[model samples]
Structures are given as structure tokens and as C-alpha cells.
Target: MPSIDLQETGLRALNTTLQSVEQKDAAYTITNPMGAHAIACGLTHEINVTIEGHAGFYCAGMNQRANVTVKGHAGVGLAENMMSGTVRVTGNASQSAGATAHGGLLIIEGDASSRCGISMKGIDIVVGGSVGHMSGFMAQAGNLVICGDAGEALGDSIYEAVIYVQGTVESLGADCEEKPMDEEHIKSLTGLLALSGINAKAEAFKRYGSARTLYNFQPDNAGDY
Candidate 1:
């Protein structure tokens, strides 16, 4: 495990160290990484980068196969548009976290603000806390697992995305619906939780997703939407 103190190191030094990292057994630990933007962006190597503190926007943007973990809260778009691998935030996340993520596993152990997982393509988001309104809006394809409460207008205008809510949903979106929990969903939820190191009973959760009513433009329902 290679430890790099971000306090005594520049962002370039930290990033350079991470970029040159090729050892899978190495844990490039960065301590006191406060609000460092693009800390590990465009990393194609398979490595584990752990930050002991907070990070700024696009912290792990465009990542290919690196796993990044933040032990503290993260700013907006924490893993914006990540390609592959995993990004885990142990604390709360700001707005638009994992926005437009194409592929990856984004695990938020705390509450997330609005537009979380907005416009996601194939990323999977598992949150242990609540999420703000309008989540999964215009989502193309993905899975959003919220173990806590959800704000108003959840899953608005969603498309081909599966949403699992364990708490109260203030309101369902334009064409979303609450569906019955089945064995398959329970297995899926269990897998997602286990992936994020969360322990919960899937039967205690509820599922919500697009009703396929607004998949295409509709005349009667499209007025308000």
C-alpha cells in the first residue's frame, strides 16, 4: 500500500502518482484530499485509489477500470460520466452525482441531492440515504437503489430505468408506477446492497419505475409533461 499525503503533494503529483500506478495490490491512499478536482480522471488502469477526505467535481470522471473510494462527502458530479469500474462515497453527495454515467457502480452511503443519477446510461447507484426530487429524469438505462426517503416527483420522465425505493416516495413521476416486489428484484437488491457493503432485507423495500406510458410523446398526457 502506497500512501501519498495530498497536503504535501500537488494535484499533479497526486494524479501523476495514480496514473503511473500499475500494481493491483497497491492501495494508493491519499490523505487530506480536500476538494481536489480531476483527482483521478481518465484513468485506464485497474487500481484502487482511496481518498481520506472530500473531492471536487468530476473527481473520477471518465474512468475506465479504476476503483475510487472517498471516505468523506463529495461535491457535484462526483463520478460524472464514468465509463467503467466503481466509485464509492462513504458520505453524503451533492447534486448531480454520477450524472450521465455510462457504466459503473456508484455507491453513496448517505443522502444525495437532486438529479442524482440524472440521464444515466448504464450505471448502478445504491444509496443508503435519501435522494432529492426529479431523480432519474430522462434516464436512458440504469438502476437507482434508494434505501431512504425520496423527494417529490421521483423518476420524472424516466426511460428504461429501474428504481427501487425502500422508503417513502413523496410523489411518482409523470409516467412511473409502484410495482410489486418479486423474488428477482429481491435478489437484485441484495446484490446491489452487497456490492456497496450494505446489509438490508430486500423484502423491506419497494420498487418504482417507468410505466412505459411516456416512453413516446403522448398527446393527452404530454400537455403537463
Candidate 2:
């Protein structure tokens, strides 16, 4: 395992070092992040990275096969557009967490701010706490599991994505509606909960998804247009 101190080496150099490493299953510890942005973006190898402090925007954007863990809070767009692997935030996360992600898993142990999982594409997000408004907006494909309450307009204009919420939702967004949780959904939720280490009953969650009402042009629904 190697350690990189952000105070001694700048973020650019640290990321460059991580990018340059060709060893398989390497591990790194980053110290003194001090809320720096883009700490470990674009890592293509299978490695383990642990950040000791808070991180700024896009901490692990576009990551591939790297297990990145943030010991503290994260700024906006944490794990944005990640292709594979896992990014875990032990603390709270700012807005747009996991936005536009294509694959992999994003686990947030604490609360997430507005627009969490917005435009998500084929990614899986598990949030241990509440998420603010407009979450899953325009989501194309993926799953968003929220263990706590959801703010206003949850899943606005979402498409083909599945959302599981354990607590109350303040409101539902356009073309989004609560669906019955069948046996398959329960099994899936159970697996996701176990995978993310979230201690919640699968039966307690309610599913939400697109109603497919807006998938095509409806002449009778001209009032919405």
C-alpha cells in the first residue's frame, strides 16, 4: 500500500500517480484531501483508494474497476459517470450524486442533496439517508435505492429506471408513480441492501418508476404540451 499526502503532493500529481500505476490490486491512501475536487477521476485499473478527509466535486468521476472510499463527506457529482467498480461515501454527499453514471455501484452512507442520481444510465445507487428534490430526473436506466425519505418531485421525468424508497416521499415527479412491489422486486431490493450493507427490511421499501405515459406523443394529453 502507498500513501499520498495532498499537502505534500498536489491533486494533479496524485491522480497522475494513480493513473500511472500498472500493478494489479494496488491500494493507496490519500491524506489531507481538504475538500479538493476531482481527487481520483479516470482510474482504469482495479485498485483500492481511501480518502481520509472530505472531497470536493466529482471525486471519482468516470472511474473503472477501482474501489474508492471516502471517509468523510463529498461535494457535488460524486462518482459521476462511473463505468464500473464501487465508490463509497461514508459521510454526506452534495447534489447530483452519481449523475449520468453508466455502470457500477455508488454507496452513500449519509444524506444526499438535490438531484441525486439525475440522468443516471445503468448505474446502481444506494443512499443510506435522505435525498433532496428532483432525484432520478430523466434517469434512463438504473436503480436508486434510498433508505430514507425523499424530497419534493422525486424521479421527475424518469425513464426505465427503478427506485426503491424506505421512507415517505414528499411528492412524485412527472410520469412517475408508485408501483406494487412483487416477489422479484423484493428479492432485488434484498440483494441491493445486502450488497450496500444497508440494514433495512426489503419489505419496507416501495417501488417507483415511469408510467410510460410520456414515452410517446398523446394527442388527448395536449394539455400537458
Candidate 3:
């Protein structure tokens, strides 16, 4: 396990080094990946990469068959358009954590900002903390489970995506509604919480999502508006 000291090298050097590695074969233990941009883009192999600090935009964009773990906070678009494999952030994440993700699992141990899983596709996002407004907006296919509270207008303009919030929500988006907690949901949430290392009881969490009415269009059913 060779360590790539990010302090010694800058973002350009990091990109060059990652690009130069063999596809789906080489592994790296990158230290001080501090705010490096596009750390592992378009990877295609069973590569295991560990980033030991804060990462900037698009840290693992277009990833494929690569397991990348971030030990600290990440900037926007953490795993944009990820094709496969897993990307785990051990700390808090910024906006658009898993934007347009195609497939794979994204785990965030801390809070994630707005639009956590925007326009997602077949990607499973698990956030251990709260998420800002408009999370899961325009999400196509996948599951977003937030073990903490969710901000305003969650799951707006969603599509085939399921967002399970265990805490309070400021407001539900168009077509979004609170549903009855069933045994299946509880089972799924239990496993998910355990995987994310969250000790909270699954039964204590409440579920909310689109009512399937606002999926196609937004309707003003409320008189308050």
C-alpha cells in the first residue's frame, strides 16, 4: 500500500498520477487528498483508493468499478455520474453529493448539503445526518435514506426515487407525502442504519416521500398557498 502524499503534490499532480495508473489494477493510499479536484474520474477496475482529507468538486466523477473512500468533508458533486462500485465519505459532504449518479452506493456518515442526490439513477445514497432543501430533486431511480432531519422542499420533482427521512422535514415537495410505516420499510431502514453505523432505532424513524400525484406535475391543493 503506497501512500500518495497530497501535501507534496498538488491537484494537477494528483490527477496526473491517478490517470497514469493502470486501469482496474493499481491501488493507492492517498494522504492529504485535501480539496483535490476530480481525484478518481472514469476509473474502470477493482481499484481501492483511500483519500485522507477534504476533497473539492467532482472527487469521484464518472467512477466505474472502483471503491473510493473519503475520510473527510467533500465539496460539491462528490460522486457525479458514478457508474458502479462504492464511494463512502466518512465526514460531512457539500451540495450535490451524488449528483446524476448512475449506479452504485454512496454513503455519507455526516450531514449532506442541498440536492444530495439530484437527478440520480439507480444509485443508493445513505446519509447519516441531515440534508438541506431540494434533496433528491429530479431523482430518476434509486433510494436516498437520511437518518437525520431533512430541510424544506425535500424530494421535489422526483422520479422513481425513494427518499426515506428518519427525522423532521420542514416541508414536503410537490407530490411528496407522508406514508404509513410498514414492516418492509422498517426492515430496509434497519439494515441501512446498521450499515451506516447509526445506532438509532429503526422504529423511531418516520418516512415521507412523493404521493405519486406530483411526480408528473405540481398541484396547488393547499389553500395556504
TM-scores of the candidates are: 0.92, 0.98, 0.86
Question: Model 3, 7-43: lDDT tens per residue?
Answer: 7877677656776676565778888776878877777
List pairs with backbone clashes in candidate 3. Answer: 24-45, 175-211, 176-210
As a whole number from 0 to 100, the lDDT of residue 224 in candidate 1 is 81
Clashes of each: 0, 0, 3
Q: How accurate is candidate 3 locally (lDDT)?
A: 0.83
How far residue 8's Cα lies from its native spot in candidate 3, in Å, is 4.1
Rank the models by TM-score, top first: 2, 1, 3
By lDDT, the candidates rank as 2, 1, 3
Residue 63 of model 1, lDDT score: 77
> In candidate 1, which residue pairs get closer than 3 Å at backbone N, Cα or C atoms, i.e. clash?
none
Compute the lDDT of residue 119 as modeled in candidate 2: 98
Model 1 regions lying over 4 Å from their true place = 219-225
- Model 1 lowest lDDT segment of ten: 214-223
Residue 30, candidate 2: alpha-carbon lDDT: 99
Return the top candidate by TM-score: 2
lDDT of 1: 0.86
